[model samples]
Target chain A: MEKTIIVNAKSKTYNIEIIDHGLKKLREKVQTVWSPRKVAVITDENVGPLYANQVQRQLNAGGFVVEVLTVPAGESSKSWMNLEKIIQQLAEKHFGRQDGILALGGGVVGDLAGLAASIYLRGIALIQLPTSLLAQVDSSVGGKTAIDLAAGKNLVGTFYQPDLVLIDPTVLLTLKSRCLVEGYGEIVKCAALVGGDFWQLTGQIKSPQAIMRNANALIEASVRFKAQIVAADETETRRRQLLNLGHTLGHAVEQAAGGRLFHGEAVAIGLYQLSRLFEQKKLTAVGVTEQISTRLQAVGLPLSDDELGTTDFYRALKHDKKIKQQQLTMIYLKKIGQPEFYCYPIKQVIGWLQQELSQKKS
Target chain B: MEKTIIVNAKSKTYNIEIIDHGLKKLREKVQTVWSPRKVAVITDENVGPLYANQVQRQLNAGGFVVEVLTVPAGESSKSWMNLEKIIQQLAEKHFGRQDGILALGGGVVGDLAGLAASIYLRGIALIQLPTSLLAQVDSSVGGKTAIDLAAGKNLVGTFYQPDLVLIDPTVLLTLKSRCLVEGYGEIVKCAALVGGDFWQLTGQIKSPQAIMRNANALIEASVRFKAQIVAADETETRRRQLLNLGHTLGHAVEQAAGGRLFHGEAVAIGLYQLSRLFEQKKLTAVGVTEQISTRLQAVGLPLSDDELGTTDFYRALKHDKKIKQQQLTMIYLKKIGQPEFYCYPIKQVIGWLQQELSQKKS
Candidate 1:
């Protein structure tokens, strides 16, 4: 389904387009809107060296300065120090006012660099070019850009919107198998939540390798699912918060692991734990956990991970950014294709984690 | 002329009232919108010992947790290391999202604490209680919050808007004579660029000592003038940039001077130099230079100070955050009250500065 959602914000109406080859008309569409004099492309070292030259050439041909800024790959680059360095480099290169920043990497780059553009002299133009499946479907579609602190992941960020999102399916062919499988977890969540023909395709995803090898169809479906959600709730005021389904524990696990695990990998383990808990509490159907587990297994993500956290898992939960008023709020799958956030108070989570971790010792 | 302009932002609107007793109504108006549970009042050694008790008592009686967070007063306190300490303090105090941070000192506190608030779990809330006249008129109104880096001043910052501004004119009476006079320089620039009655009022300032003793009327005038400019152009798009009249040279001078000279003092000299440059170039009236000198003299700001950074002035210009495209864009006053920015090619300013410094040495 190629659905379009229009977001109206402060004399600007940006369209969230979800379809294969969405990058085709982007040059024409953006040329009419943005000033093409100076476009600073921010990507990670992994992605930058791969696609920087091609993107720069195209943008330069379009009459843009097209300065390529490469940060080291992974989450560690999204820090105040990195932001300072980027700002200094941008200022040196004269990227300001009329200029725009093209975020051309994964979630970390998009979030941090997008935030940098947002507050650069109080909001510069942002053009998102997501190269990963996770970024294409989730990170790139939404305008929530920021960096992490020692306190937690994405604890410091902004609700900054990008001018346009450029997602090329061609970019997915170059991704790692683990990255593809991790992205597929979100695809499964989205299909289950949105629950339309999108679910049918995801439910029929029998082999993870097969879907990863031919991801154009999966990419299109997943992008539409995310686009519709973000378009309705651009600021994450109400509806968008639900999309954080497995993210609460997932983010904490990732943060605690200190970048050892991928976001999607953590989320898969988090989803499994939450599903089992939901079934135990009678919050979910008897067969729901099995159905989700089967789908996740097909996508090459395990139903259980013994090496997730330590005896201090409960302590790590305290560091989650979603936490407020000592209540552990988490997004859980209500059914195979439905999700919602339920507030599991901190005291109860600590008690549950203590019991679960203690059981391991026995 | 007393004018009240509505600050138009998506969040909320507040009146920028150019009148005495603006502080009294300000509290009531802000309370009507977003009432703070507690007012964590962060002040400096000088400003805190004086007005912190009074403000605390008022807010306490008004039913808000009025804890005072005081620090040593100066630009050195604006550093990242100092900001980290303040953040630690804020965390230990367990200042929740419902509570707001109030900057009761000058620009240093406003910038440092405001940056802390901006990034403390991705922004809480901000209230400006600017004591120094410079902060009261400039940083207080705008959302340009930041902390200084070891590299340069205001190297790390965000454009975070304050929920309320509480400006008590009575507090101005207690300000140091030199400090008060330095602030008057900003008002002089405001008057010169804004023109009309503001310009005429500039002539009325007899001495820095007198200005300090009686600055309520002038403070309101200065604040209201700039407030109107910012209200229309909140993020410094077009007209708001006009407020930076003489800031190019002023910022360089201030940065070079480090903490020895206050912002307003450098601005005073910058304004004087700008006026003189215009007069010399046959761009203005014969007595324009004399008028600027007289106004600054009356305000008790040392326009041609021997203590200023005559040595490291050019070096400071290299760090101007606003510098883009290798051009040093400066805001200069055309007439007594209308200021304009002239983006000079960097080489021109560098050559001229070198020649001027050599002449000064001779």
Candidate 2:
């Protein structure tokens, strides 16, 4: 059975339907929402061949004019060059503001395509069909669409909400084990923030198969927290910072690793590292670190990092957009289910990270 | 004397200050509003040398760290490449979410810089210091930040309002006659939209001197209408679209001219051509054509187009983001003040244009 979650953003309200084989009923689902004269299913090079044809056929069968546009798959495709090309093709196809773009791929493709939809004729309707576990859980729900610059990931973007997000756990059957585990990093973050029952549930999952078995329930809980956080602070001003609990160090480590570390793996290490900081501050109860580590390791996420040492971490933090007036905003766990924010001077943060790194090594 | 007009857009309300020698008091003005720790004055090659140094010095003297970054001047600078460079520089400077970007040039600079501000760290504060007449009167007040794509102009953009818009008409003293006239085209469109006193005022103006002498009143009136329209819609869904009066054909003609015709000049011609269509349909009163013609010609705005013939016009329309499912959404004048929207299929629009083109030639 399919479950639907409604994200009530200020500007627009959209539905996120979590299901099995949702792609097969793509036409019926779209038709139930709104009918457009034309539809463009924008996918990536990898996912396009896998699902683009099926998506196009369904929409076409529903008597809607459908065209599938594909960009090269991977993080690199989320560049302005690809954005330009996709925009050029959309123009050539004579797609108007009233038409729709179905973003059919992973996070990178969804981001690029959703951004194109946001800015195409000021703003248009966008339906995100997130195929990857990472996208299905995280990027797809928020109206935050962006393209990367050389300086940072998601350097250029807008808070443009999508009209719909269709998530199918069955699609995860095709995702690599690494990709699945990477998604769990975000899941763990959500579980920790939610605490209580969700935290208990997260502690039980041990492997990729266990994650798949519980994907529907976990996604619903995670998406509920994300949707609520997004609805409250769609622009990432205050409450939403909780979602970035591990992302502060995670982003730096991921960038420093230069492609060796997956985002979730880096985030896993970030969680472990920050847990130690929490322990020092007495923010979390005793043994919180062990519980987080146990949960992460059970899902095959890394608890230690050999790469991206302290110096690299400091350098990355200096360039982070979150740092204002030499002050960095860091999110920490008050407990497994409760997160809190702290703003520290760069000097103090550097010292803290140095201490953490040296202690870890010893 | 200085005047402040409040633009009450739904998402945010901002002030547009029209003053003489406004740039001289830049520091004082910014200090009154918010004291950003760092200020990045983003300008263009042409305007940067003229004002970037002075702006930076003033802000620096006010005890705020200041940096000036210049992009190559003109419409070409509104490319993805320049956007990437600007983002990189801001990130490298460690400019954070609480910082401010002072957009200190013409429409191109304001657009690119404003867009960069809107997405940097989700968003940063933007203060527009529009230099050109077009920028001051039109692009500055509307919160519409965009970059041109090869497909069409403003194909990628956002409805991100600025925190402040500072208009210094004295800066127009350095602008050329063509630039001055281009601005009048928009002024004419605004005057036509807002009938009565504004229309009479527009009809009275004849020369560049008159425009400069009456700049404050004219800008206030034009900006007032724009602000009201934006307040009601914010996004170009319904009422806001009326602002596109004369822009449909105007954009096509501008592109077809290949830099030969200025944007406002092409818009002036578009106003003229569409008036002719309205007259034929008897949708306009008998003297409407003569009044619009007299006003456009009196202001030295172009009333005829030689660069863009009918064939090129149709081709350009085919690629416009405004066209959906082969239908073109055109904004027309019901009378002097009232405007209406109509969507015409490509076939009908082509025939109408062909007839109008031959009629003009004959």
lDDT of each: 0.72, 0.84
What are the clashing pairs of model 2?
none
Question: Pairs clashing in candidate 1?
Answer: A111-A146, A192-A337, B192-B336, B192-B337, B193-B337, B193-B338, B246-B331
For B1-362, candidate 2 gives per-residue lDDT tens digits of 69888989888988888889998988888887767578888998889888888898889878888888989888989987888788888877777778889899989998999888887766888999999888888998888998887767887778889888989888888888889888989999999888899999987798887888888888889888898999998987788888888888888889888778888898899888788788788887677778899988987888778754567777786666666677778888788898788888977887878777877788
Look at candidate 1 and tell me the lDDT of residue B286.
79
RMSD of 2: 1.9
Best by DockQ: 2
Which digits, one per residue and each the tens of the lDDT, describe model 1 over residues B127-146? 77787888877777767776
Candidate 1 on A1-362: residue-level lDDT in tens?
Answer: 34455556443467655545544555665686675568888999999988888777777777777788889998889887888778777766645566788898988899988878876655678888888888877787767777866655665667777877766766777888788788877776676677667777777878756775557777776766666667677756568887877666676666566666788887877777777777777887787777777878886786555444464455567755555566667777767667777887888886786676457556
Candidate 2 Cα errors over 4 Å, as ranges: none
Q: What is the TM-score, restricted to chain A, for candidate 2?
A: 0.97
With candidate 1 superimposed using the best TM-score fit, by how many Å does residue B175's alpha carbon deviate from the native? 2.4
Chain B alone: TM-score in each candidate?
Answer: 0.89, 0.97
Show what share of the native A-B interface contacts model 1 retains.
Answer: 0.19
- Assess the local accuracy of residue A354 in candidate 2 as a C-alpha lDDT between 0 and 100: 80
